[model samples]
Target: MFKYLKNDLPASIVVFFVALPLCLGIALASGAPLFSGLIAGIVGGIVVGALSGSQIGVSGPAAGLAAIVLTAIGALGSYENFLVAVVLGGVIQVIFGVLKAGVIGYYFPSSVIKGMLTGIGIIIILKQIPHFFGYDADPEGDFAFTQVDGENTFSEILNSFKQISLGSTLVAVIGLAILILWEKVLSKKAKIFQLIQGPLVAVVFGIIFYIMFGSTDTFAIKTENLVSVPIPEDASSFLAQFSFPNFEVITRGDVLLTAFTIALVASLETLLCVEATDKLDPQKRVTPTNRELFAQGTGNIISGMIGGLPITQVIVRSSANIQSGGKTKMSAIIHGFFLLISVILIPRLLNKIPLSVLASILLLVGYKLAKPSTFKAMYAAGWKQFVPFIVTIVGIVMTDLLVGIGLGLGVGIVVILYKSYQNSHFLHIEDKSNGVHKIKMTLAEEVTFFNKGAILKELDSLPKDTHLTLDVRKTRYLDNDILEILDDFREKAKQRQIHITLLSERGEVENPDSYIEFFRLRPKTA
Candidate 1:
């Protein structure tokens, strides 16, 4: 791991810059203390990073959970009560890991996974636009389509132009340009560029720009527009930021319900990020999902114990790490240390860095994830893959992240059922017998109720004086629904003067009296 320090150290710094605004913004959005988010970020990085089996996955206070945290805080009556729920949620997640529920992450459709990453990428770009122009009504980390401030995403973008600050716009443009140059050109040209990422350079330039032209009224970027880290006045003030849980709320029904909700959501978000991060991993290293859950659980417990918000594996920081060439979990651990050190020793200095520069950094990350090439590539993979992928992207962009993924998963499941229905049976027409059609319907292995429609249709299409051979010889399991269909079809065949022959491993049974009885009487297979 130390060998990758040259890579991990720099990547950690980039992730640190990316994480700062998000930590504060998410806390503000959650209606929690601004420092709570920072605490979660710190614990996620240091604790989860240490325990997680994931090489590239980074944990933090997720924007995905902000709404839940916001609601739960109010619903539980106090933030202290909510902290109790967070701790319980952590315990629940540990149980989930123990039970190996993380295997569910493997079942997410590839198209949906790709769609989610693309959706998040798109969200990042759209969300950052207002910040890029220094319209700060919406915080830097809010990713919802409709803002809590009652402004919609497009409205904010349009408004940004009207409220654009000269200092922020200028700094953002320069910072973005520097990032692009460093990533696309300089990094390829030299190792130093790789060692010192573009995000760091952009941050330095933003600080310089803020100090230079920020005083002019026409160009000044206000304090509200910049990154706000709750600067602790002294040691006592810093200690006061940490909130202990109200253990009396532990037995409350609402608290338990909230705990379960947090566990379910946080675990799901973490699993999704684990899958996504592994896919984005250039080395293609698969993370141990169960271990990841355990790590996140531990982090959440610690975070809750100290007044921090819930933690999850975050795509934004995870992708930032990957993009910055992070080779190991060392980067995640180091980033946590940076958060601790910076907030403790140089928060005032951190407070000076402009939000526009951070927005520029995220813009680069977003572009890389939502590149036109990615869309084209998904489209090129064919409609089956592309449809869900596109739907997921659109869903996420238009709705919330989890809702969008649910939509994508719904589409994917429909596709699967459609394919299963189409593949249920094979049809072959041997109508060469002078006006008497001979249709051979071969059931697919493991035929289910989904195949009933196709079977019924095939039986209905049989012409008069036809010989129908319904073959299930290779089938292992035939659904009772199909048996009922076959029984009803036999009576119809009788009316049409069609001879029905049922063939299976048990040999031919022509015009059997009761299809259900015959199948039920047969010995059940293992």
Candidate 2:
């Protein structure tokens, strides 16, 4: 980890800049105190990063859980009460890790995972459009189908256009331009360009723009649009922000339900982020999923206990971490430290940063995730891969993340079953010396219940009076459904005057009188 300092340090700074606005935005969206999100980011980075087995995975407050957190808080009647559920959620995730349930991440098909990333990328871009224009009615944090403010995603975009702030819009445009030039032009010029990240450059320019515009009396742009970092004059003042959970609410049934919701969603999100991070790693290192779960769970437990929002392996921060040249876990750890130090030392300085600048950074991140090349590449792979990929993309775009994945998984399963049925057997007819037609049916390596229909159809369609050979040597296992098919075929063989030969591991049997009795007979001694 230390060996990656040169790369990781720079990457940590980039991730720090990317994470700051999101931390505040998500907290604002959840209706939680603004400081809670920062607390989660700090804990997610330092605590989770220290414990996690992943080299590239980064943890922080997640937008995916914003809806749940909002509802849970309202249902529980107090923010402190909601914290109890978060702690319990962490404990439950630890249990999941102990049970080795993290393998669930592996079951997701590659197409669906890619589709998920692309969908999230598109959603991020759409959600940030309002913030870029300085429209702040909805929480900058929510990314779900329905927002805390009761507006749908499209409605928010339409509303943004109507209430756009000219000053904020101008700043956003300039910030975006700077980021683009830094990435496409400046970053390629020399070694220094490669060393400094585009986000840092945009952020610096953003502060300058804010100061220049802030002094003007004619500008309609409000200073509130800039990042608002809580300024604590002393240690006690800073500690005043901390809030503890009301453990008295622990016995409530609603509290338990909320805990389960957080645990399930947070665990799933963390697993997906881990998988995505592994894919992004230049070295292609595999993370220990169970360990990741344990780390996230521990981080959440600590974060929730101290007034922080729940933490998970967030893809936005992780993606930014990777794109900025983060090489190891150290980058993640250092970013958390940066979060901690920034809030304590120079929060006013942080407040000078503009949301539009951060929006510009996120726009770049979002574009990278849903690039046109991604779609073209998926299409080039063929329809089998592209269909589910597109389905997932559309589903996520129209609905939310989990729902879209469910739809994609349903389609993916159908594709798998269809392929299985198609490859279940080999059917051919041979004419023998005596003009007898020999029909051969070779079963697949493992015949399951899914293959029942295909095998039955092939057996029933065999020409009458033909000599049939059923080969089971290559088959390692036969499901009961296929076994029953063989039994029925044996019964019909005699009536159709068909000579049936059953071939097994032992040897060939000229006539299998009863399918059940044929299996009962032992092999003859050599």
Best by TM-score: 1
Candidate 2: C-alpha lDDT: 0.86
lDDT per residue, candidate 2, 98-139, as tens digits? Answer: 999899999988999899889888988988898799886666
Error of 1 at 165 (Å): 0.6
Local lDDT at 213 for model 1? 79
Question: Compared with the true structure, what per-residue lDDT tens digits does model 1 show for residues 1-526?
Answer: 7889998999999999999999999999899999999999999999999999998888999998999999999999999999999999999999999999999899999999999999999999999988998888887777888888888888999999898888898899999999989977999998888888889999999988778878888779899878888778899998998999999989999999999999999999999999999999999999999989999999999999999999999999999999998999999999999999999999888888999889999998999889999989998999989999999999999988899999999999999888988999998997765788888989888889987777777778777898889888888888999888888887887889999899977899989999888888777771
Residue 319 displacement (Å), model 2: 0.7
Q: Which 10 successive residues of model 2 have the least lDDT summed? A: 517-526
Cα deviation of 463, candidate 2, in Å: 2.2
Question: Which lDDT values do the candidates have, in the order given?
Answer: 0.91, 0.86
Give per-residue lDDT, candidate 1, residue 461.
77
